[model samples]
Every structure is written in C-alpha cells, then in structure tokens.
Target: MSAFSDVELLHDFLTEAGDLLEDVDSKLVELEQSPEDAELLATVFRGFHTIKGGAGFLEATHLVELCHKTENLFDKLRSKKLLLDAEMMDSIMAATGEVHRMFGEMRNGHQPGAAPVELLDALDAAIEGRTVAAAAVVEQVAIQTASEQAHSPVVAEDDLDWAGLYEAVVGVAPRELEQAALSTGMATEAISRQAAAAVRPKAPASKAKAAGPATTTAKENSIRVDTVRFDQILNLSGEIGLTKNRLSCLFQSINAGVVNDDLIKSLDTVVGQLDMLVSDLQSAVMKARMQPVGRVFQKYSRLARDVSRQLGKDVELVIEGAETEVDKSILEELNDPLIHLVRNAVDHGIETIEDRIACGKNPKGIVNLSARQTGDHIVIEIQDDGRGMRPEIIREKAVEKGLISSEEAGQLSVQESLQLIFLPGFSTKDQISDISGRGVGMDVVKTNIQRLNGRIEIQSEPGHGSKITILLPLTLAILPVLMLKLEEQIYSLPLSSVREIIPIEEDRVQFVSGKPTMVVRGEVIPLLDLATLIGRESNPGPKVGVLAVSGDRACILAVDSLVGQDEVMIKPLEGIKPKGVAGATLSGEGLLVLVLELRELIEGKL
Candidate 1:
C-alpha cells in the first residue's frame, strides 16, 4: 500500500481505538460499583486483549506491554485469586491513561515514551500471593481431555474456512482490511484468519452447528459505507426537485393560455405525486445520517467519574433520551458544548458533599442529561441537583463588573440575572480556578450554540437546581419558515422563532420613551418596525402586520403584509453578517429574501 493509504488506515485505527478506550474506562467505572460482575470483567479483559494484539502488530511495544500487564491483573481478579480494592482500581485507571497517552503520541507520528517502570512493577506485585490451586486443577482436567482425544482421528481446527465468519464479525471492506494489515505489519491473509478465529465460538456444539447451513443464507451482513454516497444521492434528488419546480412554472403559464383542461389537470396530479416521491426520498436519505445520542452521551460516564473523583465530590450522572437521533454533523459539533456543560456542572454548578447535605439535598448530587424532539427542533437539557444560582449574588457581580446599574440589577428577574453569567468576562467566583469560574466557558457555549442557530434557556430555583435547555433545529439543511412582505421585498422568519401574527390598528400604538409600544393582553410589549429596523422606512398606514416573536423576551414586529407560510431551505449568509438579517432564503416566486434575527433585533432595542 502507498504512504497515503497507510496514513488513512492508521487514522481509522486511532479513531476506533480511542472509542474502545473510552468504553473500557466507562466499564471500569461500572465495575467499581458492581465489583463482583463476572461478565463485566470478561468484557474488560477482551477489550484490553484486543488493544494489546493490535498494538503488538503495529510494533508499538510499549503500548502492548502496558496492556499486557493490565490484562494480567484482570486475569488474577477474574480467577477469584485477587480481590478488587480501591488501590487496585486506581492503578488500573492510571494504566488506562498511560495507554491513551501512548496511542495519542503514536497518532501524532512519534514513538510513545516509556511508561513508569515502578507502576508496571506495582501491577505485577498485585498478582502475587494468590492461591491458584483450583485454577491448576481445572487446567489439568482440560489437558487430560485433550490428551484423551489425541489418540483418535486428528482433525485440524485450523482447516476451517473462515472468510464468511470474518466478514460477519468485522464487517469492514476487504480493501480497508488489507490496508489495515499492511499498516500494522501483518499479512492480510493472516489477519483475516485471526479475525475469524477470534469470533468463533469455543463450544463444540456451536462449532458443529456452523457446518449445517449449506443453503447460501445471503450473509445477513452490512458494511460501514461512506456518507458521501448518501450526500450525492441527496444532491441529485434536490436537482430533480428544482426541475419539477420549473415544470410547475411552465404549467401555470400554460393554464393561463388556451389549453386542454383535462390534460392540464392530469399533468398537475402527476407533478404532485412526483413531488411527494422526491420528498420521501430526501427524508429517507437524511435518516441514514441520523445516529442515536447515546454514541456521544456514553463518554460522559467516564468524564463525570474522573472529574468528581479529582474534585473530591460524589456525583452521579444520569442520561435520558439516549435513543433520540440527530444528524451526524450536529452530533459531532455538539460534543464540545456538552463536555463544557458537564464539566461546569461538576466544577461550578454542583456544591461540595457537606454543602449539599447541609442544604437538605443528597450528598451525591445528580446531573441529568436528556434530549427529545419538539416540533422541528431537538431540545437537549442538562439539569443538576446542586446549589442553584442566586439572583442577588449575580446582581451584585453584575453591578461590580459594570454590566448593569445597581438600580437595574435590583429590578432584574431571576431568569434575566442568571443570563448575565453568559456575558463575556463575567465570573462569579472569588478566585480563578483551573476547572471553571474564569468567566470563559459559558460565553463560548452560548456563541457556539448560536452559530448553529440554536437558542439556550436557563431555569433555576435558589435551593432546588438549574436546567439549561438548548433548542436546535433538527437539520440545518432545510427549515420551515413564515414568509412576510416588507415594502416590495419578501423576507422569511424561522417558524421556530415566530410566536404569532396579529393585525393591529395604528391608532392603538403608543410611544414609550421615544420607542413604539403596544398593549397585548394587559402587558406592555415593545414594537419595532421591520422596515425601519432594516433601514427602509415606509409611510404610516391604517393597519400594521404585527409579528410576535419570543426569545428571552417578547417583541412585536410590524411589517407591511403577511405573505404566507413556507418550508424553505435556509442558505447562510457567508463571510458577512447582513444588516438586521439572520439568513437568506429563496421564495417560491423565485425571489431572494432575508430572514430577521429576532434575538439580535430585541437586543438592539436595549
């Protein structure tokens, strides 16, 4: 294989190896709680064994040796000769870190540094003083049985054809396997044989049953096909849709002229059917990119455990809606924000054990992560049972930082004050710590989430807990919008942001402090004219189209006319933030229009 192929193969191996390592950490944490779980121990042993084998083939002697030693310690525990204690668990956890560092160094195209020899010696020492008399007796019985069978016909176990079994177990493409083999310095054929052997059942009865299926059972297998194929299909489907749209335009022109009504009606029906088929195809292709949130949520178990241990706090992390699926792209971008949030919950949001207990709460605080689909949005929430935010303290900090006047802070609601923490360079901690309270994380969280066109909401009670809810579009590719007219130009508003629309008489509007205000349901709500805000003023008319948009606060938008609702594909404004525009969309009338940013518009009001 070429060098490029080798690099690609190694990169893929590194990705999978990282995932496996994370799994091992999580399993180890679970074993801490259920120390006597035999199956869990077996699973951990197999994972380490697999890592060792892979590293050995790659000539990563240091990594292989580390895993080998770790595996030996597990072997002693599995055989009931050694007991699992806190010290042993800590040592194993440190070994996990060592292996991870070695893998990281190897991924960066350098040799891994030697691990601490003392740690290796300590691991070896843990296996001493174990009575293996029962293990030896069992080995003797197996050896005797094998010796008894040696006198009979010697059928070679290695003679079994294993190509089908290899495909069933690994499910990697033949070429990918070949590349992996070349990179790892193993013969492709040998690696394939080993994969088959690894998956084979040890029981004699299962081996006998493997030979009975002669009817060519279609394999019932799958491969991890590249996502680029689905993307291509989606692009082609989009082109077909555009063609259908143009054809509809032609049909409208024909209907306006002298045409056969029957033919026109038949053509319309066919076009509608084709449109539905194309939509279904798009939906199916998009679903292929959907992955359950559990893939990302699983890593939190290890993170929570390690961070809580380091901080000397006892915290339990719980996950819900692990089965909710989102686009792969969204899932990938969401990892950092989620990590930051979890770390913040542990480091800042949750109080210490004594503090929590004194507050009449569980000493081991609970951090719950959940996601669910609501309309066209996916709502992900992180709630922590800790000392929630105190609005008064936040107000004092804001006043000290000059973020708000003391009088303004005194009148602010709890929800509004909690949002002040998200401001840039705002920290509530008295002293900066390594973990958090440096006033850096939450701002980045808000910025990154906004770049994805998502909104975050904070809810808290002083003594209960706090919940941060994030609302994101299901897919960024397409969105449902409400199209409205401002003067002669049409603009779109994401339906997710729009609350409602109402027609109001111009006479009922009042000016409050040189700004337009309207009374709706006994509440004074601020109103902004869409044209004037976008720098295009129009003459006052008899009635105004009021678009009520709600974010952290509610605002009324006055436009010229309500065009209608639409399901338009949002095209981002690249390299520039348009004046008072959130995004641009193509209307059914073949016109380009801008979408207003409701949050920005409301913020501009202050």
Candidate 2:
C-alpha cells in the first residue's frame, strides 16, 4: 500500500541511516564546540549527503528534501560561504531531529510528510547573509567559537531593569512575562530570576517544532553480531553434533552387551565431551548477545548538550569506558533510566553557572558517564561535579513531603537518608520545572535497575558532587541464586543480594522498637520472617538466617534451612504470579522451586 516499492531497500536504508544520524548528532555537538574542525564538518556533511542519496533512491521525497537542505547548509558551512554561529547550528540540529522523525515513519512503511514551511524558510535564511531566527524557544544552546562570543560582556543584574528589557527585546508587556517565557522555552521561574544572563540575545527556536525524544522503544527484536562469533557458534554446533553421534553409538554398544572396560571408558569419555560441548555452546551464544556500551553512550552527548542549553547551564557530558560490553537486551532497557539520570545530573545535581562560579568551581560543570565490567556484573556510574546532595537536607525534604515521619527521619543514617530520594514523590526542589521535580526521576532509576536484578548506590558530599553507581548482572537469561528451605518447599534469593547465611543465635536476636532484630558486627539488622513476609504462618525458632540487602536496606531473612546455591534459568508462572515471587526455577531433583524477589519482599516487609 506504500509508495516505496523496495521494502528490503527501505529497511537497509533505515538501519544505516539511523546509525549515520546518531553519529551526525554527536559530531554536530562537537562541531559547535570546535567550528573550525574541517574534518568534523566534512564528516557531518557526508553523513547528510549519504542519507539524502539513499532517500532519493527510495523515492522518499520528504526525507530527501530535508536531507538535501541540511547537506547544503553544511556545504556552505564547510566552504566558508557562511560563517557558522549558534543560530545556524540550531537549525542544523533541528533538521537532524526531523530526519529521525522521518525515519520513524519510513519504518512503518509510510512515506514521511514534507519538511515544515518554517524550516525551509530558515534554511533559506541561512543561505542568504541575513539572520533569520526561527520563532519560539531554541532547541539547542549554540556552541560558538571564542571569537564569536568574545565581544559579549556579562551584564550585572543591577545594571538593567529586567522587566523593561524583556518588553523591549520580546515586544511583550511585562504582565505577559509567563507567556513570553513559554514562547522562548524558558521556565517562568528562570524568567522571574532574570536568569538569561548570557550577553547574547536569546536564540530562536529551531525551524521544526520541538521534537521530543525520537520515538524508540527498548524492545528491539533484531541484533547485529560479528561473523567471527557466528563462525564460532557454528563450529561449536558441529562439534556438538559429532559428540551426539558418538554418544548414540556408545549407547548402542552398551545395549549390545559389550561389557569391556574399553566400552565403559568410551561411554564416559563421550559423555564428558558432550557436557563440555554444551557448556561451550552456551557461552558462545551469550557472547553473541554481547554489545559495546558505547552504542548507548554515544546517544547521551546530544542529550546532555540539549538539556544543559535548555536550562541555560553550561554542562559537558564526558564518557569513559564506552567499549565495555553488556548484554544487548540489557542495553535496550538501560536507555530510559540513563536518560533520567543524565537529565537529573544536568537539572538537579549541577548548580547554575553563577552558583558554580561563586563556589569557586569551573563555570562549565562536568558530568561523567562511564561503564565498566567487574567479574560477572557491569558497573555504571553517573557522576556530576556540581552541587552534591546533603543527607540532612534530603531527610528534611523527605519529612516535609510526608514520605517519612520526623522520628523516622531522625533515625536514618546518611546512606539511608540518601536512599530516601528513591522513595516515590520525594523531591528537594521548591519550584517545579519541566525537567524535574515531581519526584519521579530517581524513583524510576531505582525501579528499573532493581527490575534488572541490579542494585544502585549513591555517594555524595555537599558542595563536591554526587555519584550514582549501578551494578547489574551480565545476563538476565541465567541467574545465580541462594536456595533456601521454607516449610519443606524451596525458594531462591538472588546471590548478589545475599551477604551470608548465618546460624540464627537466639541470644543475638533482640526486639528493637517491638520488631525482631539482630546485631551483626555492631550493625543492627531487622529480621523479617520469610513465612510472615509471604502471608504464611510465622516460622518459630528458625535456625538459619540469610543476610540480604536490597537497595540500601539490609535485613535478616529467617528460613527453615539453607539449600546452598545454584545457577538457574527462571521460567515465568503460567497464569498466576504471586507477589514476592520473581519466577520459577527447577531444583536439582527436578522439583519446581520459586525464585523470590528479594527487593519486593524486603520492601514489603519494611
């Protein structure tokens, strides 16, 4: 039904174009920082040119028209026919965003609509020697060369009446300040504070209307793997088949009554070979699912640039250890949580430019996004060199929001207080902005990380900065868990959450605030009975206790006995999923054992 005739060609174009556009975005951001980098400029130009050629081949007129305009703009930029400025860069960024939108439509087998009239006019404006600023708010903060901004001077707040200035530049009455703020994409709070302190005039909106995040989902069905890895998989599969044939022959020989040591030995050798082969095959497949974290990391540079500019803050997102590999499935789910954290670092964690200068810190705040692998887990950190969080302040905010009682707030340690931010509807901000403050950002970050069988830790020092560390298993396909016995049935806790299996000492168990508690090395840990947590009869005199931690909360889980540890593949329950149970796995004896959701159980009990 679509006008595009070649479906396969279109699919290939979308795949390649998506990657090209992402690279272009990163480079464009860099280009703004270093406008004289001819190589970067050429690379960006070629990116658009290649995309335009593909669209032309596919007869996607809308896509081609958009790309051609962008390519020409870059062409002029490279030729020195037009001096690049923040305004032109805004138009370029907007054009790329529109291209991404068009890709979305083509993916659905529909031809994209034409570029907006305003965008074409802006492109035409750039082509000529006039400044044709688009209407509304700027989508990006233009990165200008030193020479371009050198003539601009910082104006003191007392030097000008902001109300008169706003009316003069924006052609609106002072009473319409809020409406004007909306049109310029500045928060009203920012306008009230007269925060547009930059000497340059406010940049106009991009030619295209504000484009939200390119509509993408975490459920990608296709993945790319290296040919070498595929070959390794094939080689292992072939070896496994040969071993299976040998195993079959050995079984036949035994059934034929050849009772020699040679026959028995041969059978054992074949069985060992089959076991090793299967293990190798599994490792090979999991390796195939591994992808570099850079694929996700590369997307955030533009994000940081955009949000920082939107907030009128100077922030730089620095990425490290991007070559670290993670499960492809995990990489997809990580996108949103990472976006939230990065935005938080820019909006909440980083101080305003004035505050940073006043605090004797760098005017341009640095946000570090890094990833690395330790053992079988990936550790990611989002660190900001801005205003660090204060435990006391966090606790106070939590109390004010009614998330915790005054007494509860008083009893929390610094670490626990930091964890309070993860509570739903907890925020420290007095004024709400589009970026943050309804208290949902940190909550989502914690929830998503925990859902991946991971844990998040926060470290902060007021005035220094804040660091949020996340630890996640390498793969969700298999889980290593501690098996426990509860009234003759077995349940498993994720090994990552289990600190140790301690024998419950009756003397060590004490009642604190009318709740059962135990002192382990001077730290008091509350004891939650496993049976009681699941609404079953309480287990009296439970001999074994498992020390488990979820988020920053640690507790002792009383169980009937310890069944040791196992690596298992969990299967979902068919119809009914009971609370506190993550999934079902099989025990060594072929019995169905439930895998407990450690965080859910611990939080529910608390």
TM-score of each: 0.69, 0.81
**What would the per-residue lDDT of candidate 1 be over residues 1-606, giving only the tens digit for each residue?**
333236666666666776788789778878988887998898899889988887766677888888999898899889887888756776677778777778768767766787777667667766674333221121112112212212111112322222333343234432244333223333334433444354344326654455334222222122233577577677768777776886777678777884777767867776786777678777766677677788778777767766776677888888999989887767766776787788788877788998988888878888999999997779999999888888899889989988789999988887889999888878888787655666776777776676566888999887788999998877866767788876555677777777777676777788899887888878788877776665455647744555555445677788778788888655543322333455555566444455666655555564
Q: Where does candidate 2 clash, by residue pair?
A: none
lDDT of 1 at 204: 60
Error of 1 at 266 (Å): 3.6
Candidate 1 Cα outliers beyond 4 Å, as residue runs: 1-5, 56-62, 94-262, 356-362, 414-420, 447-464, 485-489, 502-550, 557-562, 573-585, 594-596, 600-605
Instruction: Write model 2 residue lDDT over 1-606, tens digit each, in one string.
Output: 443767877777888888998899899879988998899999999999999998887889988888888888888889988888877877887788778768878888788988777777788788775787653423442222111211111111112233343454344754563344324343333332332332113322331112112222213567899999999999999999999888888888889987799988988888898889888988999999999999888888888887888788999999999999999978877876887888889988899999999999999999999999999999999999988999999989999999999999899898989999899999888888767788877787787788788888999989999999999988987888999887665679989889988888889899988999999999999988887776555657557989999877899999999889899877643222234666656677654466888776766566
User: For model 1, what is the alpha-carbon lDDT of residue 119?
Assistant: 63
**Model 1, C-alpha of 424: deviation from truth (Å):** 3.7
Error of 1 at 265 (Å): 4.4
Clash count for each candidate, listed in order shown: 0, 0
